[model samples]
Target: MKRTVLAIDIGSTKICALIAEIDDDNNAQIIGAGIAKAQGLRKGSITNIELASKSIKSALNDAKRVAGTELRSAIVTISGAYTKSLNSSGIVNIPNKEITLNEIQRVMHTSLYNANIPNEFEVLHALPYNFKVDDQDFIEDPLGMNAARLEVETHIITTQKSNLNNLRKAVKAAGVEVESVVLSGYASAIAVLNADEKELGAAVVDMGGNTSNIVIHSGHAIRYNDFLGVGSNHITNDLSMALHTPLHTADNVKITYGSLYAPSNDLIELPVIGDETSSHEVSLEVVHNVIYARVEETLMIIAQSIEKSGLKEHMGAGVVLTGGFTKIEGLRELAVAILDNMPVRLAKPTDVGGLFDTLRDPSYSGAVGLIKYLADGYTAYEIDVNRRMRHAGEESATHTGSLPEEAPKFEPIAPASSTPTSAAPTPPVKDEKIAESATMVNIGSNKPVQDDQPNPISKFWNWATQLF
Candidate 1:
């Protein structure tokens, strides 16, 4: 069967919407795409819901117009700014002594339930990285294997409830329902990392206009992730300040002349901030210095984060860099220098076909990765609270298969708390249809934050006019 998939990636500098067609083999062909200048956002958080919604709508409309179709659902990208991650393990006894998909799902759900998630945060992904069947460990997939007990080690990613709600509201206001939320860093990894990189361990850093997302993938899953507030836009700001040029001019200069390599004595002219008609000359050396300073600092921070993850030693494939900022000259050389001499490879989206020329850029990694994510069913075994309950009722009436006579009943251990935990109840008998598309896990509260502020765009233009 073939179906269409939509993905939206909201960034501080731009918002991108992509629509694609997925075939029987899970290959995605880009059918439509839209990009709009981002407003009402700072460092990946929504500052003004109205303006953010408008931006999202603009991108969505553009994509729909191109595809000649209307889309109402999308798998959106969320930033790592408010995300936190932890590792947890869950074990379940195999009653039939045969591991099936149901057992795999149960163990993953148990791992999520066992995690001590913060009350203010909600789970986004519970990715199983390792599995152990009885005494044998490092099992990738134990389905159909005979084992008395199964244990799984998972990496759980969560985000703040308030921020997630704000994101959902912005998308909803754009007339789209969020199918699933994937972390920006994780999405980038899925788009760029090769099988060798994933198996041998590697780190990916997606440097955007105003934020850089970092993810470390090893043993077939993400082991660590982090966020950096600094990005290529900071270089532009530094240039504007140091050269006394307009922000736009500084951005252009950064794109034209920015480099980390040894500087030349060439001279370049820049437009003055206030006096648009008057221009001034600046040394190329000076521009390179300013850009180098910011790039160095950003790379240093990324290297530090990798070190902090404690998984650096496992990174046999080293670091892979992508995103808009990675296009800068000499970044990979500098990354190797600053990132402890680990190998660094620059990457863009791969395995994408059909109208993908624009989508091939590193800048679109997050957006393209979202399409790949939905097509691949990265979290197929994840448990959803509402879906589980609904399936439970359905299974009780239709499930007629018998378990082994000697098999023991399986139950998830509750958390140690005075208040009852809200984790999903024990897994019900297998429901064949539900198992095919079980990818969502909605765990957060339903309270919506009020948007009572004035028009953010008007205020921004007002400030701009005053400044100019």
Candidate 2:
């Protein structure tokens, strides 16, 4: 009758952990939420295992303290450039003269069977969207409907196997089972979009620190999904370079003065950081110009991706945005200017209660959305990266200068006893010497890679870390 689910949205800039309690009668409610600064990570990938683990543990502990309990399993949110999407259809015969839940599950799996992905890739979600029952089409649920044939269309979300494995490993190290990994963009869409918007077709472009995801919703299902490797972080970096300022300073300035829309034609001088008296004055026009250019490029790329999916023309409900970057002033105006005056609305997680004021921020959309996703009865398709290319640390274990095998144990041979039976066994080797040799082997086997050296494992991990 009651269930608890922990949802975490791991990002390049910060990590958001949410604890929720759900009941059939009450729907869902957020009981605890925690935020922590992310470290040892770049573009959503864990670069330093120790740092990442600590960051996650810190956030987890804060939420646990608020909830008054420890979470054993979590439904986490994952997003990166490595996240991929494709549409697949499956057909199954209805021999029982009626469709059932079993058939629905079968068809979804069938769609997965039709997916063509390399070993490095793993399917994360196989979500059924449109269903057809014989002559009845556009059916979302065909159960209990008499039909001879049942066919369903599914949207498949996948990511690099190794990338997922590393994230799961980090989370598991904090004593939580990685229950389900959902695409953050999809979760945002689920939480933000209403039935009318979904029916008419809409798009959710979740702009985060390192990845901005585009998920097109039409006919109440995911129509198109993709991610831009660059996001608001790129905008910050551009500001830092163009204005000749430190990254942290630029980040703060952008948050304070950044706007995608144009303002009055005037210049305002502001005190520059790292200086006691000197002030820097820049044209508001110039500021908006920089912000506009980067955001426009991002929007254009999203437009092109949607066009490729053939969903660009069908966005009748227009675009809804959810993420930290959406807080920028005049972003909606700028989006309309570049998107042909299309409607745009900023949204946060909706249709849930508890700790309402805190979780209402657009930044918490993905983390909160995950709770709704898991509570609504969904399946998580795990990626199988067990056979993936060996990680650098594991590979180094075998190549770290050959370790001597432990010498076989031996017993002292009986004296020949004047029978000349076994060539008078040689003097037994010293027990202490053998024991010392075994210890050396054991130490070598556990040797860790030097921290100063480059890690090939993280190199591969970083390549696909641009997730949702």
Candidate 3:
């Protein structure tokens, strides 16, 4: 199918939009893109609906202009405050000692049922960490195996219903349906972390303008997730306060001279805008100290979160840093210093087929990941049909009758409306079609707190032990 998808990344610093086409071969190629400065949003929370809407509209219009096509829906990236995560498990007895896709689906669903939350919150994602069939672990697929019982572990993420609704309303007002809302940290991981890193366990920290999202993946799946309330914005604020300068000047100074490590006796001079005949002088060390302090503290909290998840010591793949904040000069070095034992690198989006150059920037990681996910083509619900087929085929081995005609059909359904009405209307969607694509994420922990980073192998081992 020749499909086109619009992906939007709404961040505290900026709003980015991308339009991509999925070829019959399932390759997603970026065709258009747009970015606009954000307003009235703080640390991923909407503070002013009108201003946020304007920011979104600007980005959407820019994308429309670039694509030269009208868009009706978009896949969005969500993060920051109000987002939460959890770990849940599901168990199902293998029916008749034959593993079937239906059975697998049932077991997975059983796990999701345990993610209880208030009615005001909605699940954004329920990712399968891995599966264990009768003591055999890490079985990616178990359609035809003979197992007495199946156990599955998954990670669930959810956000406040009102927050999501506000986002949806803004998109709708801009004439687009939110096809899906993915967490920014998760989206960044999709773009940056490789298969091995995911398998061995890794952490991704996306530092945006007003927030930093921390996601921990172990066993090639997301096990722990959280976000820091501070981001680059805090650094800028610190600069403004310390230098007695306006925010605009502080931002410019940060971009121009920010560093995590600076040398003493280092002085640089520059002309202050609108100033008379005097040039302002400042030491690079001063700038570096300010930048280093905030960066290190934030990273420390992220490290602490990983430790609490107990996966910090086991991250064999190390740390992957993405988002706008990563653009700061020497930030990668800063990450390495604070993280302690794990390898640290800046992550940028790679592998898109067309107009790829534009999407390669770290800033666009969320948009790229959202597109990659849409192009992957596998929905969580496909397990049922696969299981049913496997079960029927096994049943046919004993008795011939063309397998019962009871296999079900799968279809796509619109996401249940989160729109608030005059009356309460959000209900648990019972439609099977929606169920097939329905993914549940857990919102269990608040932001985590770790001390210093640890060895990568230790991080991996920690996750490895947790999987069982």
Among these predictions, the greatest lDDT belongs to 1
Q: What order do candidates take by lDDT, descending?
A: 1, 3, 2
RMSD of each: 17.7, 20.0, 15.8
Stretch of 10 with least lDDT, candidate 1: 436-445
In model 1, the runs with Cα more than 4 Å from the true position are 377-468
Off by over 4 Å in 2: 264-283, 377-468
Task: Give candidate 2's whole-model lDDT.
Answer: 0.69
Q: Model 3, residue 8: displacement in angstroms?
A: 0.4
* Inter-residue clash pairs, candidate 1: none
- Candidate number of the best TM-score: 1
- At residue 161, give the lDDT of candidate 1: 90
Estimate every model's Cα lDDT from 0 to 1: 0.79, 0.69, 0.70
In each prediction, how many residue pairs overlap at the backbone (N, C-alpha, C within less than 3 A)? 0, 6, 29
lDDT of 1 by residue, 106-220 (tens): 6766677678999999877777778899999989768789987789888888999999899999999999988778889888998999989999999999999999999998878
